[model samples]
Target: MKDQQDIVDNPPPGGSTGDPFTISNSLNAAQTVTVWIAKGTRWSDRDQVKAIKVVYADGTARVHGNQTGTSHSFKFDSDERVTSMGIWTGDRVDRIKWETNQNRTFDHGGWGGTEHSEELGNGILLGFSGSADSHELISLGASFREDSD
Candidate 1:
């Protein structure tokens, strides 16, 4: 019999556009996440999240969104896993922060929107899903596997 997985999804906030995308790792946990932030003169059209890439424990990886900014990487220890995430968004994603079980944290991007955070107690981050345009990431969300215990 196939293993049953309990997946929890957090939908993106309103005012998001462009092609829909989902990047996931059904079998392996996430090991690293890289985010690209574009620093532009204008806050409305630029200075936002450009793209994201997640590398799984299995050495497999996936990248989404646009590629037009400086890249920042968040690497996790072998025994560590993501516990929660915080996002700031408006018409586009403005900032992102990730906290791990080890209490390590990584924050990036400009602060220019409403803040949304989620604490996934004991849950393992599997992937991310949302919408993005050719210029930046319009919206962002997350998917995780709930702890069975």
Candidate 2:
């Protein structure tokens, strides 16, 4: 487990634009995560991430960015917890991948851009913070807390 002092907010990746948003789950764990991926009108353009929604164990939910693409949802098992995440970004978020403690993996979006991976070694995902526009997600970052056990 990581030290409590080591848990801190990660800065958003990519060329972030638009208003900043923060969605936190400090007291509970996440139950589900949904991501939206959008493709450009032109055939040569690559796909980009549009939005993300997370539902917590308490039944409360929060979402950011725009709903302008295909949506993919991943539900966690009772004992499953997200252990790490990877994001690819350019001018916008291009791809996202999440891995659970159970070794389950969930992925979304297209492959094009710089990749940023977060390995949360026993740390709890506390929430997300980032910037987004009406058309797509501009940037994303994860927040974590030290595992108490």
Candidate 3:
């Protein structure tokens, strides 16, 4: 078992910051990890929490937020918005989805290039695994596995 400090300098391969929940180690097939967290900070204000999540790095992922309540006997919470989101990695997006938030169709958005497109995935939908602003350079298809079936 690894600790939060371990994954800091030497993060696992293909890791990312989209991970709202921190992972302590690599997950094996059919394996589940329960983040005990022991004690930590949720915000800069140092708000504490029983925040927990199930990290499964096999086929898909499940991200949920804990509302933290009582009389519920306390249990693992689930968030569908970001649940089982597909990961896209490549030169071009496997799919160019909502660059913004609206609700329309593919290759189409509002009047000002604003995307109200389909919610194919989560986050920006096209946040690009990379950290830049080079959408025009991205072509129709990325040879990366994230695009190819």
Q: Give the best candidate by TM-score.
A: 1
Task: Give the TM-scores of the predictions, in the order they appear.
Answer: 0.86, 0.85, 0.17
For candidate 2, write residues 21-100 as lDDT tens digits. Answer: 88776645567778888884322388888888889888889999887778999887877767778888887888888888
Q: Taking the tens digit of each residue's C-alpha lDDT, what string does model 3 give over 16-41? A: 32222232223222122121111112
Where model 1 places Cα greater than 4 Å from the true spot, the runs are 1-5, 40-46, 119-121
Q: Any residue pairs clashing in model 2, and if so which? A: none
Better of 1 and 3 by TM-score: 1
In candidate 2, where is summed lDDT lowest over 10 consecutive residues? 1-10
lDDT per residue for candidate 1 within 1-149, as digits (tens), equals 21335666778752457788888877456778899998632365546788889998788999988877789998778777677788788878888888878998888888788888854635577678888877778888877666652
Which pairs, if any, clash in model 1?
none
The better candidate by TM-score, 2 or 3, is 2
Q: Look at candidate 1 and tell me the lDDT of residue 69.
A: 78
Q: Tell me the number of clashing residue pairs for each predicted model.
A: 0, 0, 3
Report the lDDT of model 3 for residue 54.
34
Model 2 stretches astray by more than 4 angstroms: 1-7, 40-44, 121-123
Steric clash count of candidate 3: 3
